[model samples]
Target: MSQTNDYPLSAVPQSARKGFWSTAFVLLGFTFFTSTMWAGGTLGTSFSFGELLWIILIGNLLLGSYAAGLAYVAYKTGLNSVLLGRYCFGEQGSKLADFVLGFTQIGWYAWGTATIAIILVKLLELPEAYTTPLMIVFGFGFCITAFIGYQALALLSKISVPAMLAFIGISIYQGSIDIGGLAQLSNISPTDSMPFAAAITMVFGTFVSGGTQATNWSRFAKSGRIAVVTTLLAFFIGNGLMVFVGAFGAMIYQQADIVDVLVAQGFILIAVLMLFANIWTTQDNTIYNFAAAGCNLLRTDKRRTITVVGAAIGTVLAVFGMYNMLIPFLILLGTFIPPIGAIIMADFWFKHRSNPPSLDKIKLPAFDACGLSAYAVGSAAAYFSPWIAPLVGIVVSASVYALLLYIRSAQPVAKPSAS
Candidate 1:
């Protein structure tokens, strides 16, 4: 296949790549920090102080391991994370993976767009009609940013990432001193208490696919070490910072909305910058993935089709006020995301024995009955299991796919006779 327009499909060589620390910084910037804090603050306000900490610690540990494992798999496999699902899912079965991933990207983009719109409206005291158009414009801008692809994204991240970190640091310093000491922080809680499991699920759900994205980004890294180190460092620093801020914010505001609390604390500038960076990086990465998946599905150039389609979808959703409802959207995302990760890991690590044919070399297979059945069973397991849906789904799907593949291979087939 010809290279897609403006998309960085080729891998970067180790000799030509930047140092690990620099790469780590870029990854941290790309991941950004505020979203986690925002999500955590939301969760913390709804849960007990001790419960919130347990969720963050446990959730990040699982998500971090999953992200690392998936990244390693993608590095060794040299395939797009979603494309790796083809081994188990078959060529057609992979489309289900694409749909789940693509829609989740769209949902996140819409949510971020709506969030920016609401913030701008509140900050400037703008009229509803004016703010609505602004939302569409901003949403379209996000699509365009992703259309420019990796280089532009890196540049944007470099600029916004530091600003976001500084803002968070300042906020933490202010909150710590103002809200008494660390011990007093736990005393503050939200009006509506959230369960610990639910909180952990929300945090894990946000980053479960994050590792999958790391694989895409890691393709750009110079070496496997660079890929591994950069990803881990980024998650620890960027994501860790967010969690800290979230915990602090929860202690201070006793509310779920971090932006509101930031404003109240007279850190409005920092709040705005953090919000913009969080949404911008997230939307850019998501649009790129959406476009890549769309291109793969259509057998076309991703850049040309993805930019046009993503922008239209993002704009329409923003105009319709679709993104504001985030909690429900996240809950829905939790349902299907685990299976995708499971299928990818199963295909790369077991089905292919860590080696799959090159993208150009392999011919697409017909829908695999075993893969689909596994997915069906896995989804049901996730829905029914109360603890760690992603973990449960992975075990259920991987075992089923492996067992069925074994059975299929063991059965003898008749040989065709030469005329």
Candidate 2:
């Protein structure tokens, strides 16, 4: 299919025929080289051996299943998936969905820019004063690439993915030789007490909110089977690779920063390449989604909005002190993500009974106060609950929405008079 200047909103058959391997590679690149892994690096620095193992086992099981399940839903529901929230949130409720997704994308873009700045400063031994300017330059560069849209982003992924994978392979091979054996590396851990649950949350949180962006990529898949296969492959392989490298780093180096660990391992070139590649993949998607959300809310040209807003926000965050607050920012993403997934799944699967109406013919069903109430309650429950906020939020919201639908259906309708 030929590339177009306009943003393609619908899934055209011509665009959907990308080969399975190509799709798989793109998915793998995106998932593997994300900030979540960097966040996991921090987690690995704190968690004990047994606890980290438990987190990897349980968190991967749960989150990987969720990613596959949501991809299946997207396959069935199609392009206007987010708009299906009309059944629960009213006609305007979808805007709230857009805002949540958009705001998070902006945050991710800012974080990516900061990560690039951090990598460059450490790599070159630059002073603190140079970090902000470098970050702004990186941010602007990412915004320009993202403003070019999906095809450009896909090409970027193709180039970056192989280079990153090769670098990772080289690092692992060298690190294993230096450290004696793989078994010795596998047995080692951070030697500190970090909650297993927190580790699990970080793994799940990294990709859970990604459901919103699934359609953006999957819409181009040739079939539902392709989407399912590609998504499962990406989530499992990508996350597995991240944890594997994290474990290796933990076993060999005691440093808290992953870049430092890479440099110490004599893989400084690979370190810089991986860092840049990872940040670019993440920033592209982040800016793309932010622009899409703006178009949805304002009915404006995506190119204009994305370029202007992405550059403006990216520049501001790079200039200000936002990147310095990574943990708090990530925790905030963890908090609200489950609710959006809950609402999307509930609206598309249950209320519509697995058949969403045409996008052009969309109807705003009566506002489900019960559903909205459940979201509020669920969000609160997530905050208060000690062990499983994500699970609680999903259950509460779904149950509330289901109950409301049942009640409304049970009511008898008035009969019309015959002339």
Candidate 3:
């Protein structure tokens, strides 16, 4: 049975699906950040500027294409990624995905909030005690934006995106002049020679999860066409810029975040504005993602209430430095997320080969042993393997799942329950 595009879900309803530019800007806001620039710093010192650009561009394209697949399904069904997981992993089994996805978003929210406070302390030359209260203030403040949901995020993005771009533009101009123009900057020798393969993986690994989670916001897309084009633009242009900023900063000023370099260069006011704008765009989505995931996990419609509670939890975690400590773990876990998208893509394309199945019409297991088992194996391959961990995981998981489904299809078709 084919699913209706406008079927009412817990968080997203037909009335809430957004237009192309709104969804595109929101996704662009999510991708635009300072930390991404920081990741570029590492690549800058290691690889030639031309080499780094190619790596970042190609990496974002691959990650975008992978994410576009997930966004396509979300666009078709008006379902978030977690809800879509129910079809492949079983109804109850999806709760596990809900927890993981939601928990990671909370961690990111907390870390982002805490980083703001840290930046303030440094900028003002204040004591560490100021950090805690600052974290509380911004953390709760951003939570309010998220609790208000899409409207607030869209509004914030409208203001912040342009402000951020202008600030970055100024920094780029100043940095280029300081380095004696593009010709000199490009001619500079790399301080360290990072292997070409490692650099590519680093670029891909930087935000592989964000690319996969594109559906979180892309679900609101008016059409799959909008979803794909906008998502690729976010990854290819928006994310690619982040890498260039980081790499450029590192090569010129030994800094990754342009905001940090701005401060060091006596552009304190611009730095403050840039920092807040960069972090706010990412955190609003992070907290909203937690709320959306919470709605799915608890089977509730209290998105605002959950937002408040989740923000409080995240703020508390930030104060304790717990969220900061999880950075490496979170990056490692990102490898596993792409496999979920791959399995979902396989289930929809190979099995149905048309519109998505109606959740109410199709019979599903409480737990899909084959899907879960494949997830574990794929995660292991991503963790243990050296090459293109995400690709490896996707191929392995999809192959395993397709094979299992093929075997199942060979068996007698069980009738769905009437009740």
Candidate 4:
């Protein structure tokens, strides 16, 4: 399944597999922003400083574990998440997962593009007429980066990651001074409070779906160990830093956005740099995933066309202000996505324990009744369960899938004997 030099298919081929650093950099760029800080801002407003630390740690640990396992399989299989879903959900049926993963990414892309567009307008004091074209420009610009494929995304990330960090460092230092230093802020207790369970859900819900789609980039890993270790490292450190920046900014300046904090502190140039770099890093990856998922749905390798179409669709949605009103959709995405990954892991462990067959080699069913049923059951539990909905979805789906597989395996094989 070799793809052209110009286009890597939705299901990436082995030839395009990247080294650990490249994979890590891209994953880090993907996991590094947009929601972590927002969730941290929410947490800071609700919980005490000590409580926030524990929640961030525990929540991210769960996320890291989830990503580590999925990343390894992606590295070994050389398939994106939607392609992996086909083995469990059926080639025709996987469009559901593709729709969910792809749709959500497009939503995020629109929101990010719109957000930056609005911010740029404010920064430059441009007329309102500029918003729509700005959305179109940024939308198409980001899409082009993704259309160029993983190599370009990784190269941009190499620069964006460090630039983002340098500014975050400066923000932390200035924010600390404003709050009378780290010792003072650390000692102050929170005025508002959130339930522990709700806080944990908030953390996971922020990126659980994106984390599940990690194979979109991580499949490029040179080895399973590199994939697992680097993926976990990115989730823990890259995402955790996002949370810390938000919490620090919120507590000190009553602001969640570091860019806002920089502007208030009169570092307008630095503020502009941070704002562009942060959103661009993630938005391009979002478009990349959109193209991958589109390729899966259309069963084609024309990634560039899909990228352009996705960017256009997202830009239109942003213009209409539709992307921001999709909190419920995002929540649904969190609940449903984890089970897909869980089923993939269970199928690999139970059915292909000794040797997992490649897509071309395996005799696959049209759809696995057990896998599809298990996913539905998991989604129901996630919606109804009081706590840790994503976790419940994973555990229930995996357990049900594994049990079905075990039952099938238990049927005795016929033996021929001499009488």
Task: Choose the strongest candidate by TM-score.
Answer: 4
How much lDDT does each candidate structure score? 0.68, 0.66, 0.79, 0.80
Q: Candidate 4, which segments miss by more than 4 Å at Cα?
A: 1-15, 326-330, 411-419
Task: Spell out the clash pairs found in candidate 1.
Answer: 46-194
Model 3 CA deviation exceeding 4 Å by range: 1-14, 193-195, 322-327, 413-419
**Model 4 lDDT tens row, 1-419:** 33332234444566667887888888888877755686788678777788888988987888788878888788777777888877878877777788988988898888888888888898879999998899889988877678777778889889998888899888888877888878887676676777787677777767777788888877878788888988888887788778878887788888787888898887999989888888888988888888888888888878888888999999988999954664455467668888888888887677777256777776777777778888888888888889887788889999988888788678898799879
Q: How far off is model 1, as Cα RMSD?
A: 2.7
Task: Name the lDDT value of residue 325 in candidate 3.
Answer: 61
Whole-structure CA lDDT of model 4: 0.80
TM-score of model number 4: 0.93
Minimal lDDT window, size 10, model 1: 1-10
* Candidate order by decreasing TM-score: 4, 3, 1, 2
Model 3 lDDT on a 0 to 1 scale: 0.79
Between candidates 3 and 4, the TM-score winner:
4
lDDT of 1 at 235: 62
Using lDDT, give the best candidate's number.
4
